[model samples]
Target: MSPGDGNDDDLYGGTGQTRTRLPDGGQGDMYGGAARRPARSSSRSLITVVGVVVLLVAAIAFANRGNSSSDDGDAKKPDTSPTAPTGTKAVTSGFAHDKQGAQSAAANYAVQLGSAEMFNKAQRDRILQEVITPSRVTGFEDTLDKAYSPEFNTNVGLNKDGSSPQGYTFVSRTTPIGTKATGYSASTANVAVWCSGLLGMAGENSKNPVTNSWFTISMKLEWTGGDWKIVTHSQKDGPAPVPGDERASSSDEIANAVEGYGGFTYAR
Candidate 1:
């Protein structure tokens, strides 16, 4: 059930959807026949939950560290590049034509393909144009068009039109932990990106509250059109770790955190 596999049921297991895990709090199951209202809690509880989340984030950073080597000191050097691409464009391009470039391209492609924007046809097409090889765009589009059907949209707690409900916000984002490039050549490369993602609906009564998952995306990239573009890609679950003891946040708290935080642009 890799991304672009065209099996709607496996969408989340593959790449685009999030598998909802029922928490201690009574949260509804969006696809489990009937929906239940989320349990309510006070802001103090939310603040405590936020503190737990921060700790979990720190743990993730620690887990993602590359293995030590003779160049461990070099690895510890801070990245000088901006956290994001320096432009007003929605997606960045002009990657270097090398292994590092291919890794960067693959990481960014994973983010775009895993984004909530992929649910909307127009935005999806635009993203494909930017990140996918031109010749493969139609094939990818055809696959995703079927994969992101109305029923599929509803199952993920979005409108049939792939829009968020009036009071709900759909969340889909991918953060690359690291990337490795192998089978590199002047014109092509293979890159695998270790990623952590957040996906689901965020609202007071969201049937599917946002949850996180870890997976790796393997991409085949070609240096085409003066930039590295995805020829094809697939995803497999984990490299996931055991759950931490952190308390799950309320739907409102999760929603607020997503809105307050911005994402980074990953590179090797």
Candidate 2:
């Protein structure tokens, strides 16, 4: 269809074409020979443009109001420096002498508990004996032994000796976000460790793939055998964020990287 044909509907007004009589009074041509529209006065056009700009600005401001509220609400205000510890005075006072020491102990203990060594029976038993309460150490060892059985290792693509297969590299590493003492006494404290971890195998044709996990590990700690030891511990999933852009490393590279890296003894 030809644009603006008389047969076509006119979106703005009447017929697509208009006729105007000539001043001489003869038959007038359609559109008066491409009739020109009445020119808008400069003042009127300026007013129209100003009105449109005002409406656009108002609409943009309204749309941004909600965004401004969110920005203001989501931002945390800066905390004023504290004069001294204020809450739970009794619990704080009981462990006052050992606050720093306890935090350091819990952080280091968390790293060890989440290490790959926990998958090996001998190494695990030794760790438990060193880091767990005397009364609960045996029970914890037995439970962990049951948990890290041959079947479990096989499920994770690990050999019976708790080693990764020839071509597959098992990656299990925990990064601690922070640690807090929820309950503290002269002899006992409940420490919670927030952590993110990477676990699984990275290898061509590998059945298991590396995945990230966020979890909070809570440990019931006791001052036993002259040092802090874990009596019990539990884990729950996270406050996780969206994944980022990073290429996955190959199995051999992952294995070598883990071998080359050494774990740290954390302190707060």
lDDT (tens digit, per residue) of candidate 2 on 96-202: 23645566566555555555556667756666566666776666655455556687567556797777787665655556688888888888887776766555555
C-alpha RMSD by candidate, in order: 11.0, 31.7
Question: How much does candidate 1 score in TM-score?
Answer: 0.71
Question: Which predicted model would earn the best lDDT?
Answer: 1
lDDT of 1: 0.56
For candidate 2, the 10 contiguous residues with the lowest summed lDDT are: 53-62
Global Cα lDDT for candidate 2: 0.44
Q: Over 4 Å off in model 1, which ranges?
A: 1-18, 22-87, 265-268
TM-score of each: 0.71, 0.60
The reply for model 2, stretches above 4 Å from the true place, is 1-97
Q: List the global CA lDDT of all models.
A: 0.56, 0.44
Candidate 1 lDDT over 1-268, as tens digits, reads 3234444223223322223453445355332323342232221121111111100011011111221222433333332221222222323477778888788777767766666666677866776677778887776677666656798677666799978888776666667889999689999999888877666677775656666766666777888878898775655556877777566776676666666554543334
